[model samples]
Structure formats: structure tokens, C-alpha cells
Target: MDLEILNQEIDDDEAAYRVRVVRRVHYLTISRKPTAVLDIDTLCRPYLLIPKLPPFPDGNWTKMRISQAANGETEHVLSWDPLDGIHSLWHPRQVDVLSLKRTADHKARVKEVQFDGRILLSKVAIFEWWIPRLQRETEFYERISKDHCLGSGSVAPTFLGHIMEQERCVGFLLEKIDGRHPLLDDHPACEAALRKLHCIGWVHGDVNICNFLVHQSTGHVKLIDFEYAEPFEETKAQLELQKLKDEFSQMTER
Candidate 1:
């Protein structure tokens, strides 16, 4: 596909947003499934991508006919018009930018960047709905830090701070780990990490292989993506454990 994510302008009162982009897609060679090329920006610099959704046009109009001076059609750009979209702003200067680990989607975008002389993972939210989860996670780390009953060690990456863009708190930063996702052999360590969280009256609401990071040199397992996590409840904690068990079982079958 000859596609590139270009920034387009959609001004005037008709459209509510000033920025938008359509789409550039590439299909998997084997599956032929299309995926958006949202991470088209270069490495090391910071960017802010917000959701640009405008109000829909009033009518079930499918076809649009543009009129000429003699023809019977209105040549006006109304509130309802054909549009592509906008996202991911990239600057052309040789500036330090974060290495994109994943594209900016509605849920979240992960990137690697240099912050305070340390390489950290930046999980940023592109939409307003997801911003709360990042805020909750920051509070989660704060609570853990104050509690004296739990061990000093943390199974999750160290919480760095909030990622601000356009004067908005979108997400939080975290210590980047040099590790890979847990495999069948790493199941035991993964469970041990999960249990450690439960022992502290917290349930990692989302438990899957992807959320568990196994360290390279130490072989330590760490949990991530705590968007669904919450205070410990007996039933909820057991359900989270069962989710881990089920995932391991499926891996074993594979």
C-alpha cells in the first residue's frame, strides 16, 4: 500500500477539530490482515497525539455530488463532508525523540525515551478515556511506597512520573526492563510475582503472558499494564489468579 500518515488540516466551524489524518495500511504477508501505520514518527523526540473526532453530519447521506457553477449542487464545505483524519505529529529537526515500541492507538501508546539520563518506558494515552488509568497507576505506586507491611521490593517496574503533553496529564513513565514476555518455562516465576501483589491487598486485574516481563540477567518476573488493577478483594483476587492459571494451561497445550 502506498500509504503515509500525513497531517491534514480540517478548519472552519463546520468541523470541530483542526487536525486529522486518514490512514495508511499494510497487510501481513501471510494473513493479509491490515494494520495502521501510526508510529511513523522518528526516534527520540516527544509527541502529543490527541483524539480528533468531530460531530457527525446530520443525515444518512452516502454519496456526495459536488456542483459546478451551472450544475444543480452546492459547492460548500458543510459540517458534514468527506474526510480522512489526523494523528501523530512528527517534527523534522534532528531532535531527541522516543523510540516507539508501539503505535498510538485509542487505548495507549508505548515508547522508549531518554529521561533524566535514564532510558525509560513511556506509556502515553492518546484519548481522554484512558488518561484516568494512568493516573490510577501513579497512585498505585504511591500507595505501595507508603505501606510498611509489604516487602520493600516491587514486582512492577518503578514508576517514574506523569507524561504531560499540551498541558494535559496523559500517562505515566516507568523504568524500562531489559526482559522478554514469560514463556511456558517462566510460569512459576510469573505466578510468584502475581501472588506478591495479592499479599499486599492488591489484585492485578489483568494477568496474561504479555503483562509479565522476565528479566534477562536476574530472571526476575515483573508485572505491567495495571489499567484494570484495583484494591484486593477475596473474589477478585482469586479470579485474577485463575486467569493466570488458565493462560498457563493454554500455553502448555500449545
Candidate 2:
């Protein structure tokens, strides 16, 4: 859904309450504009499931969707006139997520986010509403479309992006690994995949079964989801390294 925050103001009576011009959300597939206004607090409520949060007044990356970039050429669908449609998210720095209201509509529900209007990114995902951390994550994936994990196995998004409702602040875009199935035990295929990732120094923060996809036809496996991945490491850095090794062993054994 297309989301745009216009202007925001605080209520004189309450510290938590505020009024803002919330642009009507539009499903990218259907070019519709927001026809209503929404009032919310500068501070969003605790709904998004975050184990810990970054220091306030600061912005961190979050995942919003998991999808592969659409390959076939089609008319561009997610564009709007600057004067008519609200184009981007509010700046992430200026706004804080105090409360999030879930929509009844499933489609609208997946694209909604709860954060202040302060922090915003210039790059907006025209197609998807997931991956709040990086707008248009699928678009970003397009940048890495040519990248490969093992020697021959091809990788791509398996599903469209989806929002983690429990963790309202985060979003994810999953890729479809067309014909590959994840290696269950220690196998050469798994080792090659990890070796490839290590050669590039690319880290997969959450290396679990759910985070992987296998192509049945080629035995090619593709990795997806980067909600928690970062080049910079902190306390659990070694653990991440170990996890990669473990995955290698598991696949080799299979």
C-alpha cells in the first residue's frame, strides 16, 4: 500500500496525543489515494515485537517484506503525480512509533507501519509495503539479482513481502527459490553455499531453515531475509560465525 504522511501536530491537552494528515494508503497494484485523515501520538505503542530497540531519536534498519523482483517487463505501476499522491514515508529521525492501528483489510494490513514521521528514506518501494527498514526491499534485491550463493544454483524471491505484525516496526521480503530445496544435512551443496557467503564476507544474521529456500530442480538453495543482518557486529558476532559453520556441517551430512 502506498503510505504518505503529510503534516503532524501535537495536542495541547495531552503530551501523547497529536493530529496529522495521514495520506490514504494505496495498494500499489491499485492506484488509489488516501481520502481520510488520521490522528496519532508522536510516540507509538509497543506492539511490534522487538527484543530490544535502538536508542530513541535514532533510526535503525528494519525488514518489511520478502519478495523477488518482478522480471518480466510491464508498465510501471507505482507512480503518482507529485502534487496528487503522497510519495514517500515521513523522515524516520523526526518521528517515533508510539502506537500502530491495524487495518481490518488483509492487504492494507500488510503494508501499514507505526512510526513517527521524522525518519524517512528517499528510496520508496513502489510495489511493496513490507520492509519498513528499507523501503522497496525487493527493489534492492534487484540490485543483487545477479549474485549467486553456490557455483550454479540460482536464487530468487519465493514470496511477496509481508509485515511482521507482532513486530510492527520490522518488515520482510522473501524470495522464491524456484526449484531448490534447503539441504537438511551436511552436504557439498550446503558447504558450497556457506563458502560462497564467507568468501564475500556476507553475513546472514538469522541462518535457520525458515530463512532458506531450495530449488527442487537444480538442488540450488537461495538465502532470503536480512532484517537483522549488518556488516558491523556486536556481542554475538562469534555466534553468527559458528551458526554459518553449523549450517555447512548440517548440509554436508545430508
Candidate 3:
């Protein structure tokens, strides 16, 4: 698919935000899955140099739309109508909207980002887009930092945030790890870290090679993401341990 960078505008109104981009994407067809392959390098640069977003029609500040691109087959390549506003944001796993209370967990910042299929790119680029969205809310990030730095301990970005809908599934954030080699596929450090988490009365349902991060400075490994963490009774520890063992076994087999 051919997606040309057109124009983007960010309308920030408290908790509501609308990011509109005007661009010509070639393959938004039924047989073809439309992909938004954003490059990290392209987004790294400051957005001030880009052209200002076209003014909204009828001067309705609450809603803004952009005419993306025009094609021979269609009028425009990709376009979105005026997005009204973001309503109440939901917690990842909280079933009752009334229970969408923010957590009081200390040590790391937590925020939500869009996890829909519309955003697509390399893994790195995909991460780059989602990271900022989590950090954009100043209040959320600052609160967690006051407690402790969350995520991969030794400088690698920690994923303390989540994207759960039915259950509380989110990830966290931490300082970026630098110049560190990840642990070998089979290493004791993996089990040790999970042990630490269990001791803290937390259970990580998913503990694979990808879930752990190594701190190069101290050779310490950190448990980064807690999306699957849940409180488990002692009686369930054995079951959970078996699950963890099974997960590790599968990783080793692969």
C-alpha cells in the first residue's frame, strides 16, 4: 500500500483529543488490508515544520475533519469526519463503567493508548506511537514517577501500561535500557524475577522470554509488563506455578 504523508493536526481539549491526518493511501480495499506504516524516524522530528491542519468547517471547534487525499478511483484517499469528542475513557478490564477508578499503585506511571488495528508499522514504530500517547497525559505520568520507576529496571523502557477491555489488561513505562544484552533463552534469571513478583503477592499470567528485561548496569533482570498480573490466593500458587512452568517449557521448545 502506498501511504503518502499528508498533514496532521492535534486538537487537545482536556481529556478529549483528535488527531486527524490527511493522506493518500493506495490499498484500502477489501482484498487488501490498509496499513498505517509510520516510521519512528519520521515521527521523531518535531511536528512544527509540517503544514498546519486545514481549518474545520463551520467553525465547530469541538469537531475537526480533514480531506486526506484524492484518487482517480475515489474522491479522497483517506479521510475522517469531525470526531465529536472522546467520552468517558474506560479502564482496561473494569466491567462496570462506575468502577473505572484509577489505581493507586506507586512507582510508575500508567496511561492508556489506542490499540486498534488502524495503526500499523514495524514493531519499533508501533511502539513509538503508543509510547507517547501514554505519556501525553502529564498528570498520569508524574504520579507514577513519584513512587518508583516502573518497567525494565536498568534503563530499558518498562511497559507498565495495559490495553484490556473486559479485564484489567494494561502495560507500564520505565526508563529505557541501554547497551544491554538480553538474557539467554534459558536462564535462571527468568524464574528468579517471577519469584520476586509472586513474593510481592502478584501473579504474572504471561511470563515468556519477551516479558522480561535485563538491566545491563547491575545485571539485574526486571519484570516489565504487568498486564496479566492479578491477585492470587496461596492455594492457587501451585496452579499458577505450573502454568508458568508450562509457558517456560513452551518457550524452550520453540
| Per-candidate local distance difference test | 0.54, 0.35, 0.36
**Model 2 per-residue lDDT tens digits across residues 122-163:** 222222323443433333343344343223443334322332
- Sort order, TM-score high to low: 1, 3, 2
Kindly list the per-residue Cα lDDT of model 3 for residues 124-196, writing each as its tens digit.
1011134433333222333334435444442224323232212222222233343243444535666676676
True-structure Cα RMSD, model 3: 13.5
* Full ranking by lDDT: 1, 3, 2
Determine which window of 10 residues in candidate 3 has minimal summed lDDT: 24-33
lDDT of 2 at 170: 32
lDDT at 129 for candidate 1?
Answer: 40
- What is the lDDT for 86 in model 1? 17
Indicate whether candidate 2 or candidate 3 has the larger lDDT. Answer: 3
- 1 or 2, greater by TM-score: 1
Task: Specify the highest-lDDT model's number.
Answer: 1
